[model samples]
Target: MKLETTHASADVASEVVFEAKGLKKEYDDGRVHALRGVNFRITQGEFVVILGPSGCGKTTLLQMLGALAEPSAGILHYRGKSLADLADPASYRAREIGIIFQAFHLLPTFTAVENVQMPMFETDRPAAERTERAVELLKLVALGHRLDHFPSKLSGGEKQRVAIARSLANGPTVLLADEPTGNLDSENSKKILELIIRLRREQNMTLVLVTHDLNIARMATRTIEMKDGLIVADQQVPQTAA
Candidate 1:
């Protein structure tokens, strides 16, 4: 089954999904600045790739976009509302945003289907419905046959596929993936990238991915290059005719 598109007001649908103004992040008692006054906006249904070298703040910016961490300074808006002002940030994350990390992050004991069903536990859906949806998602990721396999029994690529399916469990409008291909081999990386691109096209989801691979960055609709905690360049990828 195909995933459903996110519902939104016309005004909200037309607006940018994420807007960051002078965004900054500091640590080590303000001794280290991870993100320095970065400003960017991600429009709805766009696939944006954040590209930078190590320690250049690409992951930090991704964290901010995913609501995994709060910015030390500057303003961040999600659909025209300040992220800090949200009444329930956890609920916002659970319902509106999905995050996938470099690590697979699957529970070792749970089967692939169980792992995918974990996200639905936060909602009020019945258990049977959740299992059905999880099964369907695993099939979408080409893991239908591995439903009963634990993480240890699966290959690295298969684990990542499970993670991807889990990320979509909530039908989020925005998907934030940070170095999703980092741990995969070249072949596996290509497969994962293609899967992500297909999902974005099929679901009309807004994708924000962080990667150091230029080839991976080239596949995005927009590429944002960062260096020394600042945005160095932002360019649109030229479209190839179908």
Candidate 2:
């Protein structure tokens, strides 16, 4: 199973980061299917949008990619290695994959900076280094002034910004975002999208974002549309020039 390799810099960024074959996820003793025999390859630095309506299995597929959930039947490989082979999925998640949910799952007790540092503890980085890095990330997302603010104190947009910073704490190679703008207002949603795009460019990150917004899907270089637990369409779209 040899994959095409490329030269250094931008060329090497074309290598596959994730590959799936016959991927399926089921529930209730196979009575409910979330993902149905999906197959795809996501390359490094690719911006992929999983577009579909509610209950279309986009989130389920994303969970599998992040190793938060296992596939019921089929192989899910990350960088050519099966996710099932990973001895510690937690480590894989903390150090390799970053996930952002729409809920802005920030701990109510922690400040913005503290929430960002939370992921680094799992990677066992030095305490001081974690705090320093967290501060840098928050500042990058324009939340430096709000470092001491807790989730309850921050606005919807600000909280989501903190979540984005927290997701990048470990410098993950890939970022999976599930309906990140669902809870945001139009103005905030545009801001969040811009921030994400900027970070993606600066980091040269591989991003898989799940959204039902057709306009949002147009921003992706490629889009995979899921329906009734299956990928009904997958095709190229105009890439965002930003």
TM-score of each: 0.96, 0.94
Candidate 2 runs further than 4 Å off: 1-12, 240-242
Task: Give model 1's TM-score versus the native structure.
Answer: 0.96
lDDT assessment of candidate 2: 0.87
Model 1, span 163-182: residue lDDT tens? 99999998988889989999
Q: Please report the TM-score between candidate 2 and the true structure.
A: 0.94
> Largest TM-score belongs to which candidate?
1
Mark the 10 consecutive residues where model 2 has the least summed lDDT.
1-10
Assess each prediction's global lDDT (C-alpha) against the native: 0.88, 0.87
* Predicted candidate 2, C-alpha RMSD: 4.5
Q: What is the lDDT of residue 11 in candidate 2?
A: 54
lDDT of 2 by residue, 56-84 (tens): 89999999999989999999999889997
Best by lDDT: 1
